[model samples]
Target: MSDLFPLTVRDAVASRQGKRLVGPVNLDLSGQGACVVLGPNGSGKTTLLRLLHGIARLNKGQITWSCPKAEAQRRQAFVFQHPVMLRRSVLDNLAYPLLLRGVPRKSAQTEAAKMAERIGVSQMLDRPARVLSGGERQKVSLGRALICKPDLLFLDEPSASLDGRATREIEDILQSAKSAGTALILATHDMGQARRLADRVVFLLGGQVHEEGTATDFFARPKTQEAAAFLKGDIVEC
Candidate 1:
């Protein structure tokens, strides 16, 4: 259906407990390469990702997809920072998304097995998903997320709390997904990872977008002082 391009957000805002969390921001997703959200700690990167992915309620403004709502929903997926694993076998975890999409059980499991192999966890297919190691769980999460071949994927700190090897492994999977035409909107604090993966960049500070542009230009020469400071390893505050 490939109709989720140019997803637009205007004057969007979200709040929690009477406090602004993110938004009063604007953005457009043209179904391009990976878009990376960058900021220091507590800078609303996660909130912005959630907002864009339809996880966080939009308390104000609007987020509009170019396609029909149902089609848009069907083409989208979200991967949380702390991956949520069902209390079932890894195979079952991988099959769950397909099952939700009404894929036949036998077909879903068959596809799940293939995905497990793709994510390098086929040997752990029978293991309890909840008991798997951190890296394994994240792999299963990626496998599930990719099983349906979502057109756009929202990822929140997919490499957080993992070792170098594990982080690299996750990055590889993400890269593979991107190659297969799944647009990525990712949130991260790792500058190196951002530089490696980002095609476009959105820098958030104080619950609003500080600066945004092509990753090349943003990294090479940020127009805003806050973005420059952020790139220099200095902290940014509202």
Candidate 2:
């Protein structure tokens, strides 16, 4: 009864300030694996992620989950592009989610230590989280999200400010989480990152899905001109 899956979005649409942003889109997600979302600027990738994570209200259509809406909400976590740090020590920041779940502080800190090690932030556990650099804060954000052990994790440009080594560390952590049965929906413009982490791909352009398929097919045999152009590093106009 703890499982949250078979998340379905049918003809979903969203708008902000009277301007259409995303959708007339359909998406189905179940089981476990990484689904990487690829799109250029203004393609509504973030909007789509927000929509799935229950942050943004839908203007039309339906989003259904196999479990109850509240259950699904509880089983999911989201890591934003620009992470906001709490005015607390790194260790506390990482342990906060578990603490909220009523786990003892010491027990939560122990789990937080393990997650920090996974994200390569164990050395900074005693530092004030808000004083850390952007990339370091992002690491803590990811650690906090992963420590909760959600069924699905939504990440938006998670490694944007990370160095090569840090990016690899984060990717490895994501893979480990996937092996632990947590599905991932990540949005990034970094094609290399997509190639490394994606099991499936959803390519968006002009607030619409230009292509959706297995990573293999989407990269090798894109079905749409926009997708083909995007894969070939050409500008995708309209």
Candidate 3:
């Protein structure tokens, strides 16, 4: 883990309108394999990801990237449950990120085409992104994220709204990204997904970490009752 991305958070706190949404928390995320965050709604999973991505400012504590901000930004990409697409063709949507980063147009298009093919949406390249199905749109969104060749990828319920087959496809894409040396941080409530994708698990409750450990241990013998209930498919009493 130490040899990975070496991300560290020291007593971090985030606030919204003077209300503490997260923190007095400490965490370390390595750049190897996938780290899955599991929790119920309002557990601050998305908040934590925003903080780490520098999209939200920390009110207290420090988030040390262990690298320059520019390098960190270039090495990371984030995908949300509802991915936004411009009113353009799927190929254009997929090439947007690379275009912003100043990659040559030809190179961007070529790379975007390759990614689209990988995600099984190449045929939709000429179609308007706004007209694609939910699953197809997500595939395009994933292709856009991967086109950057990011070292770290954050996914906020990437398959939350998809059907079974779509969910499996997204999971397969994540696995491929992991195999390509991209560190993945995923926020999901799906236990089955955790079992399939997580190497380590971070369980959060009330905006704080309840447990963190290898996925196998956490699922087999959860140290906390809340986690145990969650893993057992029982309602977690707040």
User: What TM-score do all the candidates reach, one by one?
Assistant: 0.97, 0.95, 0.96
Compare the candidates by TM-score and give the number of the best one.
1
Q: Distance (Å) between predicted and true CA of 22, model 1?
A: 1.1
Query: What lDDT score is found at residue 182 in candidate 1?
Result: 91
lDDT by residue for model 3 over 1-238, one digit each (tens)?
3233689989999999998888877888777799998888887899998888889889999988778877787788999889888999999999999999899999989989998889999888899999988888888888889888888889999998789999999999999989988899999978799899999999988788889988889988999889988888887643
Q: Kindly list the per-residue Cα lDDT of model 1 for residues 97-182, writing each as its tens digit.
A: 88987999999999999998899998988999999889888888888888889999999999989999999999999999998889
**Order of all candidates by TM-score, from best down to worst?**
1, 3, 2
- Residue pairs clashing in model 2 are none
Clashes of 2: 0
Please report the TM-score between candidate 1 and the true structure: 0.97
Over the full model, what C-alpha lDDT does candidate 1 score relative to the true structure?
0.90
Residue-wise C-alpha lDDT for candidate 2, range 1-238, written one tens digit per residue: 1367777889999999998899888887764589999988899999999998999989998999998899889988999999999999999999999999999999999999998888888999999999998778888888899898888999999899778877887788889888888899999988999999999999988787778889999988999878888888998764
Each model's backbone clash number:
0, 0, 1
Task: Sort all candidates by lDDT, best to worst.
Answer: 1, 2, 3
Q: All predictions: root-mean-square deviation over Cα? A: 1.2, 1.6, 1.5
